[model samples]
Target: MIRWTSSRALPSVDDVILLAGFGLGLSLIVAIGAQNAFVLRQGVRREHVGVVVAVCAASDAVLYIVGGAGLGALVEAHPGFVTAARWAGAVVVIAYGALAARRALRGGEELVAATDGAVPDAGRRLRPVLLTALALTWLNPHVYLDTVVLQGALAASYGDDRWWFTAGAVLSSVVWFVALGYGARSAAPLLRRPGAWRVVDGVIALVMVAVAVSLVAGA
Candidate 1:
């Protein structure tokens, strides 16, 4: 009556899946970047947050699937890819930094609608979201190393139930984006205040500049 299965030898299946997903989600969410910053800005300004959230979540899901399918190794093998990505990311970070700094220097009312004016038609918005997500997810060798390659490798450690782990990880991105996009709206009141907006934007600018510098140095 002492027969034991592999499942019993380790953590429960659900726990494994949750842990993998939660870890991946948390790791990706920590950094301040264009996509997330944009989302937060939009949320505060009362833009089309649902669509924005959907776009982010959808793009992330697609990339994660590609990674989980084992395409990360290809990215890792290409040093050129990483080098180019770092440069590109640097450009984005610097540009974002400039924008954030401008907003911070200006008053809240001026900054509130800054991002809103930049929105294109529905089609254009979707294009940017997809492209940005792709660049962020694919072009960046780090994403490949972390999400696609490393996460995939870990998921594979589960053998037959790896899919469960993958699903959890994907869900993490979904949940976080939704929460962030929505939660950011709470800052609208403060964002309405010119002084407060300046402070927030100042922080955004600093973060972006730092990221850009780091990228260039690392490259």
Candidate 2:
């Protein structure tokens, strides 16, 4: 996955493991969640996009590093942490979902691209945005259940090349977050119409509530 193979240089078995990690990580992280929805909203607003993307990518990289380093085992041993996170995540996600639903119903929100003739909305202060991003990432139980636990178990299947697998997964996180955040920014202009923005918010609301429901049901 890192590079194409040539006749002179065949790919090693570990390379295959790395590629597997990259593919699996991307597939898992791309799922709809409160965090991803918030990232997209912030991206559309062009508010702290760089910081949000960095926080997400760096957090995922940390999870992958720890997952491969036995932190997964520790997390598994303590079920209470997961339980608490699940409840907390559900609460926060539900609240966010309700807010999004209200905005969608009200239909006042509209996108203003930086390229627009007038100044675009600057959005909220940096501190609140930063805190919200952090909370959405760390408080979510999926970060532990799906990422650390499930991915770590899969990484173990690589045996001696587990770290390579972890590295590839980490790379996927960085690439996905960068693409999602900046990609949304590029599409901000498409949401200039209030109707389009309302649709985006409605979609985000559904995703957030869906995630919350999943967490509650699983718990």
Candidate 3:
């Protein structure tokens, strides 16, 4: 009988750093589900984009660390954890969907135009972005899997030196959120028109509803 021993292969320094960061960042974000849309909307408004990004990045960092620390195993093992997350996520998504439906139901005539020189309502500016960001982060199961389980698992793939991988992943989250928040700001010109704002709001509502439906269906 021939016995085969598994050799632990370590990823190259460059590869580990790049892959870990890229994987973590992309996993947490890069999806046009609920969060990204909200962020983009806020960015266009030039209101509280920084706050939204900060919250999102911070949330990701915490969750990623917890997941990397093997907390994901607990989530996976405990049926209650999944149940709670799913229910919580479902409720959040539904709420967003309802908001979107309301916007969609409102005709284009009622839409506000985005004018660069004109000031926006302060309350409107902050509430939507913050609420959307929170909903995206809290409601989506994929977000957990991406940051916590998947990112952590990727970091752990480095055998013994998993910290290096995790560092890269964490960095990616920061960079991506900052970029996303800032990038959205650049589109303010296009988003500021009343018609444009209405359209954007309508789209957001549709996406929210669709995502909510998906969550319920999956559940």
Q: What lDDT tens digits, residue by residue, belong to model 1 across residues 8-27?
A: 56678577556645554444
Ranking by lDDT: 2, 1, 3
lDDT per residue (tens digit) for residues 1-219 in model 2: 599667687788778667757765765675546787777777766788899999999999988887776743544566455556556656766776787788778886654432344233466688998999899989999788656766665554444566887888898899988887878766656655677757766776776676567557756
Q: Provide the TM-score for each candidate, comma-separated.
A: 0.51, 0.61, 0.53
Worst 10 residues of 1 by lDDT: 114-123
Off by more than 4 A, model 2 = 1-8, 71-120, 187-219
Higher-scoring candidate on TM-score, 1 or 2: 2
> Worst 10-residue stretch by lDDT in candidate 3?
109-118
TM-score of model 1 relative to the true fold?
0.51
lDDT of 2: 0.70
Off by over 4 Å in 1: 1-11, 71-141, 187-219
- Against the reference, the lDDT scores of all candidates come to 0.59, 0.70, 0.58
Give the TM-score (vs. native) of candidate 2: 0.61
lDDT of 3 by residue, 72-179 (tens): 455546645544544454566456556555654663432123223434334666666667778878788877866776556544443344456566667777887777
> CA lDDT of 164 in candidate 1?
73
